[model samples]
Target: MRNASIHPRTLGYLGRALSLEYSAVQQYMTQAALAEAWGLRDAADRFRHETVEEMQHAERLIKRMLGLGVAPNASQLRPAGLAYGLVELLLQDAALEAEIVALYDEATNFCRRIADTENAEFFNALLQDELQHAAEIETWLESLGVARRTTEDERAYF
Candidate 1:
């Protein structure tokens, strides 16, 4: 049997990352339902698709944690403060994506510093996905003439 050991800190980070991923899935699902209720079928479809992607990400992370012999924990997720409206939903998603991007960036850096090449590569790919998600949402918001931008002083996470 091959023996692989993961740092305790890395395991803790993975646990936190898993929670974030779970939260994202829930948020996307809520957003999708809200869009459908508001009679925006296209928007709802997009949100649903995004939710599926988030779920997949969570599963991947879970598998990685297990492979590393780390116990996976699902903690309560942070709430996303969002008002009830289409514009609000889009803006919230964009902001959330940005936060996720920042998180993955940090994780990647940490992995590299610890010489965890595999995790660093994985996080780098996740960061790219997050950036794309943010860009897509921003484009949609801009098309709707909703100018949304996050300031540096704003909180890093939702």
Candidate 2:
């Protein structure tokens, strides 16, 4: 934490983002384990990789909070829901990424309002990363030929 002043609203948003990132890490890790148990080795690996990325995002938020003299709060995490199958898991992941993208967008705007150019840029980059994650999940789902209509079809289970 530095001696410089940080906007309270900016700090609050960062803390929320940190907690969300922690939740994402937990969700991805749990999904990875579930995929492995279901014999989806490739999906498991991808989930595990995403788990690492979420952890890294959390670390970045923590470091930023510390640099601003604000304590990082990872305690208010959102509960992660379990998916019954691979398509469901992918849908959940895409939804999670979309939520994260929205959060980062708000955070970036908040940082801009506070004249915190550095943090604004950081959040922007994070937003880009999350968008990419969501896009990849969408592509994967499409590759499986799982359209919206087939999302809940028990026969679509792989």
Candidate 3:
């Protein structure tokens, strides 16, 4: 492996991100399969599209790691929860996206602190992507008359 000149923490974050991206790919694909089994054609298609997008994210992270002379690690994976219904799936996806967005935001801050503007920008872009996904999921959930979380609940947390 080529010597990655970046800080160790930066490398650690990138590796974690790579692992998460791979996990997302697996999760989305599995969701797609489950949707198909449940005869939810539209949901299945959306999940498949999400699976492809997650794969693309993983590929980009791997390429970036390799470019930095670091080997990408995908070992830090967790089991993807198989939601019971369409509404559950949307809620799960929204939560997952929110988690990823927070992680990427932290990574972006770390990159900026280390003066790696390029990586910081990359992480920021990922954050935006995830935020959009989260918003879409929330909208769909609301349209389906499923309440993942109420605004009052959020207010209580603050």
Better of 1 and 3 by TM-score: 3
Give residue 73's lDDT in candidate 2 (0 to 100): 78
Candidate 2 lDDT over residue span 1-158, tens digit each: 45456677777778778888998998999999999999999989999999999999989998877777777777787777887899998887777777777788888888888798988998999988887887788789999887543334222221
Each candidate's root-mean-square deviation in Å? 3.2, 6.0, 2.9
Alpha-carbon deviation at 16 in model 1, angstroms: 1.4
Residue runs of model 3 more than 4 Å from their true location after superposition? 1-4, 150-158
Question: Model 1 TM-score?
Answer: 0.88
Task: Give the per-residue lDDT digits (tens) of candidate 1, residues 97-148.
Answer: 7777877888888889999999888888877887788878878998899877
Q: By summed lDDT, which 10 consecutive residues of candidate 3 come out lowest?
A: 149-158
- The whole-model lDDT of each prediction reads 0.80, 0.81, 0.81
The TM-score of candidate 2 is: 0.87
Query: Which digits, one per residue and each the tens of the lDDT, describe model 3 over residues 1-158?
Result: 76556788878878888888888888888899999999999989999999988888888888888888877787788688877898877777876776787788889998898899998998998888887777778788988987676344233221
**Model 2, 35: alpha-carbon shift in Å?**
0.4
